[model samples]
Target chain A: MKLKQLFKLVLINIYHNKMRTFLTTLGVIVGTATIFLVVAIGKGGEAQVNEQYSKLNVGTIIIMPAQRGKVIDPLTKKDAELFQKSKNIAAAFPILNGSGDIKYNNYSDKSSYLGIMPQYQEASNLNLLGGRFLTEEDEKKKARNAVVGFELANVLTDGSPEDILEKTIDINRRKFEVVGVLKRMGDSGSRQSVDDSAFIPYSSAERYLLGTRANPVINAQATGLETVKGAIQDITNILNENHRLGGAEQFRIMDAGSRLASAQETARTMSLLLLSVAVVVLVVSGIGIMNVMFVTVKERTKEIGTLKAIGAKKKEILGQFLAESVVISLVGGILGVILGFANLPVLKYFQLPALPSLSGVLLGLFFSVTTGIFFGFYPAWQAAELNPIDALRYE
Target chain B: MGKESKCIIDARNIVKIYQNGAEELKVLDDVSVKVMKNDFIAILGPSGSGKSTLMNVLGCLDLPTSGQYFLDGIDILTAKEDQLAEIRNKKIGFVFQKFNLLPRLNAVQNVMLPLLYRGVEEEEAVRIAKEKLKMLGLGDRLNHRPNELSGGQQQRVAIARAIVGNPPLILADEPTGNLDSKSSMEAIKIFKELNQARNTIVLITHDTEVAEQMKRVVYIKDGRLFQN
Candidate 1:
């Protein structure tokens, strides 16, 4: 039979049994929709992580002490100086962080305090939203000056930083003038509030706050992130040499870039797992279509016999049934794409995270159509192979 | 019929056996018949006399158990199932007692079914179907479905479907069995017209009146051919 006639026949058959066709196509629709939704969730999670990662300096690396059960790094000034003089290391600064109370004339509040070097601003990509950052001269002169975080500055003073730059605040029973206030970094990849902190010169912190404490934890930045591994290795070797461990492990080094890469790899694996599950659902849906087609062939036995007696070839009969199945699945798949795309805003409304990609939609459609063809073939073949004599004799 | 004339159908020493469980029951035995082009013949038989079984074999719908059956010089008993079906489609047409019109299709579409299966163009197929229906006196009922038409009109539609493809041989298996006498006579009148128009027809019927309407009659009793 001509393809057009076959198409018309399929349409007429479906139209004759609208409810059955709709129910059969519903399985395919739900399967496809589930796949698209799962993939969107995975994509959404990855995109969220990437957006968070983009806010920081890509070339910066965090070096935390890796000693067992020890949260603080115990490096001395000599070690910090050695790292600052290493090749390809533009700048390095030791950071000694602690929580303390800041008292400013009945406006006392508790916040984190960090003792950082002058170059810490350049290394950490810290933007100062108020006054200037710590200076090398302030460190050399051991000036009791401090730069407050944006939130800390607001809590300590009633007006802007200019109105409170010369104000003195007592820390550990010592009075320090806030010469400058650092800007709020908003939130870090660690998801902690960085705006509620105070910055002071590293030397003064070592002399007064820490009381001759050894080198604290430090953060450094590289000119190029591609060389971050090499930079970390270089820093590790220098620290080992300076600590007199005779090339043995003395200080631990950690690379944030490598950590981020590992996180992304984990996300990719999760996405793949989700997609595989979706494919399984689609395969099951295909089997359902095949089963329904078989039932349809049995129901239309007389019809098949009539067409065969009228000169329709086996291939023509097969094409007619296959066309019916394919039309059902393809139509279901198209509606699935629409449903999947429509789910994006719904997810956004619930704030559940969903990234609907065009590639995912196309992939779902391709699978649904292929499922129809693959599953429809066997039933169609069975219908075509039916003997006209037996079929006509069948009630 | 003269030996020189082409016999549209010739069956000799035909036999058909049905296997039910272990016992083999013979349905037809040593049946022989000949029909020439344009001859209107009737096979008269009672129930279970194998008239319908013989019709199935002659229509290329079933293979005889052991026999020689030829249709238009082709060995129908030896032809493949698909080939037999093609011969039936292109050279023979059938009108069943129940009319057997697809309930979903209207009169015109019902008549166009065989041509559509033969891959005829839609416009030409529709034109021929309309013309045949008109000729069958169903012109005004072209858009009516089977349920909407009267018993006689439905049979006329079936007859139109049978002859629209212009097949040389037409088979009617109790074509008037379901109709009233008046309607049956009307259907017979159409069959007479088709026969006079040079269309060979083989009609199976038990009604003496129906058989008398044909030019010749062959009788079958207990699966064996007999003289009427």
Candidate 2:
């Protein structure tokens, strides 16, 4: 028979029993939807991690003093000078981190403190919500000024950045002037609480906070990510020469780029794991389709016999059943894609994060059609192989 | 008939055996018959008398265990299943007792099925099917499904389907078995008209009255043919 006539027959057959067709396609719908949702969620996590990683300067290397064995201490001015003298090191900043109690009028709270050189703001990529960041002149003059985080300033004074400027805050019994306020960084899994910290000049921190400590932790910036390893080696050699340490027993260097890479790798592994689970669901659903098709073949035996008696070729019979299976799966796949796409806006309406993309929809369609072809073949073949006499004899 | 005239079917020593465990039961034993073109012939018998088996073999629906059966001078007993289907499509049309019209198709669509199977274009198939239905006095029932039509109207639709492809031979197995007397007479009149119009037909029936309506009658008993 011509394919057009065969298609018309299949359509009429399916239309004759609409409820059974829909129920049989439901398995494909659920399977495809699961695949799309899982892929979208995986992409969502990847985007989140990539966004967090982008916040840091790529190829930046952090150098600090080694303590006990391999632990690094906060950066100090002496270490910064030693790194600056090295050839491969492009830029360096001495950093000191500590938690101290601050009191402004009757509002007293404990907040994180970061003491760093003026160049640290440029290297750290900090966004300023109000006032200005610390200047080079301010660092050179050993100015006892600080930049307050947005949340920290809110806790300290009941005013804006203009109102809180030059306000005195007692940090460990030493008073410092607030120069600027940093912007609000959104909440994520990263451990750094940029919202609750105060920034100060490194020189003043060394005088007041470091006391008799020899070396402080440092944040070093490289020209590019490719040069970060070389910069770390250069800084390590300089630090060893300055501190008079022996070979292989001196200081440790931490690369923020490597940490970001490991974080991305973990995210990729998790996404793959979730996708595997979704694949299992798709396979089980394919098996369900095969089972339903087998039942359909059994139920339609008399119909097949009648068709054969009317001079339909075996291939024509096979084509009809295969067309029915494909129609069921394709319809289900389309519905699943729509459902998956619709989920994004619904999630956004509820303020929940969701990622839906074209690739996910394509994957769902590919798997659904493949499942149809895979599961629809055997039953169609069996129907085609049916003996006309026996099938006609069947009640 | 002249020697140049075609004999639509010719069979010799046709035998069919069914295996039940170790015992083989014969369904058709050494039956030989010939049907000429445009002749209306009927095979009459009671239940289990092997008439249906003879019809099946004549319709090319089953191959005899041992026999030489020729349809349109082609040895159908040696033909493949697909080839047999092709021959059935091009040479024979069948009408079943149960009005085996597809419930989903309208009268016109069901009539168009054989032509469509023969690879006729849709427009031509529809035109031919409409002409056949109109000839069968079913012009008003073209769009009605099988369940929507009366018993006689449905049988007329089945007749239209059988004759629409213009196959040389028509096989009707108890064509009026499910209809009332009036409807059965109407079906029989249509069959007589078709046979008079030069269409070869084979009718299988247990009713002697139905068998007498045909020009020639053959009786079978206990899987063997009886000369009458």
Candidate 3:
């Protein structure tokens, strides 16, 4: 039989039984939609991770005291100074993390602050929107100056960056000049959002805000991407010798690449889990298709017999039934792609990241069609193999 | 018929048995029959007399347990299933008691089925089907589905479908069983007309009245055959 005519026959049958066709393809629709959405969300997560990491210097590494037994000398300013002189390390600074209530005129809000040296600006890839960042003179003189984050500057003063810069803000009852307003970089990969924090000289933070009792972490930048390993090695040796640690490791070293890797791994794991769920749904939907095809063949037994008597070969019979199933799934797949696209706005409403991709849509369609073929074959074969005598005799 | 008249159906010592596990029930026993070209014959039997089984075997729908059967000079016993399908497509037209029109298809589409299966172009099939339906007094009902037609109209449509391909033989099993008396007479008239037009026909039924109208009658009783 001509394929087009055969398809028309299948279509006529499917069209007449609208409810059955809709119900049979429902599972496939949901399955493929899920597949598409899962892929989009996975891509969104990867893009998010990449964007976060891209905001920071690639050679930046964080060294913190690996909390085990206390009383081992914590990383100090002297240790940071030693790292700055090391051949592999290009720049190093001790970071003192603290939160304080800031008062700018009548507006007051609690914000976290990072205390670091002037070199920390380049190491952290901080971009200024107005004025200049902290200088060597400011660190050496222990001047009370702060470079506010984009959001912090908005909160402390007028929304304008130029207005926020050079404005004085009260931090823990001490006045500090806002020398610069940093550009917005959103949430960092390794820490809290940089947009909500302020940067100040480490000398002033140690002497005035956080006292000598607070432990400080050292942030360092390698001379080049290739020197990161050597930089980490130099940091460990310096901290071990300076702190007088014998055999046990005291500090934990983390590089930007490793952090990016772990984030990517998390994204990949989530994608795999969702893909499995989509597969399960597809399998269950496939079984549904198989079940419906069986019922259809049974119900059309006399019709099958009639067609056989009229000269339809077994393969023609098989093709008609199989094509019916494939068309059902193909329709479902197309609807699923539309549904997936439709869900993008809902995800956005919930503030979830999702990036629609062509590959995801293709994969979803491929899965649905494969499911149809895999589950549709046996039932079609059964219809083709039916005895014409019994079939025609069937009530 | 003359000695030169070719046999359309020639069966010798045909036997059909139905097996249920270890128990076996014989449906046909040593039944032999011959049908010459353009012959009109009826095999008459009551229920359980295996008349339907004989129709099935003769239609090449089921294989006999032991038999040498030839359909239009082609060996039915040795022909493969696909070969039987092809032969049935090109040589046999079947009209059933139920009419058996596919409900989803319109009259024309249903009538075009055999030709479609024979790989006829759809346009040609449709055109031929329309002409056949017109000749069968179904011209106004070309697009009507089976349910939309009366039993007689549905039967006419089935006859149109059966003869649309102009096959050599028409096998009808209780073709008038589902029709009213008036429709049954009309169906019988059409079959006689077809037979007179040089198309071979074998009608299976238990109704003596229906069988009496045929040119030849064969009686089947409890899997055995007798002719008068």
TM-score of each: 0.79, 0.83, 0.91
What's chain A's TM-score in each predicted model? 0.75, 0.80, 0.92
Best prediction by DockQ: 3
lDDT values for all models:
0.81, 0.82, 0.90
lDDT of 3 at A246: 43
Tens-digit lDDT string for candidate 1 (B1-228)? 565377988889999998999999888999989989989999999989999898888888788999898888888866776677688789888888878777777899889989988889989999999999999888899999899999999999989988989997899999999999899989999999999898999999988889987999999888999856
Q: Write the per-residue lDDT of candidate 2 for residues A1-395, one digit (tens) a residue.
A: 78888888888988887887787777778778777877787787678777777777876777644564343333347777777766666788777777779777777678778877888887767888877899887788878898887777878785554466778887877899888888877654455577778888877777787565535567778777778878878876776666653432455688878877787787678768867776777677778778877988898787677678778888888888888888778887888788777777775787544588888899999888888888888999999989877787676
Measured with C-alpha atoms, the lDDT of residue B68 in candidate 3 is 95
Residue range A151-220, candidate 3, lDDT tens digits: 8878767576558777898888889998988998777754566788888899988888988655788888
State each model's C-alpha RMSD to the native. Answer: 5.5, 4.7, 3.0
- In model 3, the clashing pairs are none
Number of clashes recorded per candidate = 2, 7, 0
Best model number under TM-score: 3
Model 3 misses residue B37 by how many Å?
3.0
Every model's DockQ: 0.49, 0.59, 0.82
Q: Please say which candidate is ahead in DockQ: 2 or 3.
A: 3
Q: Rank the candidates by TM-score, best first.
A: 3, 2, 1
> Interface RMSD (Å) of model 2?
1.2
Location of the lowest summed lDDT over 10 successive residues in candidate 1 chain A: A242-251
Sort by lDDT, top down from the best = 3, 2, 1
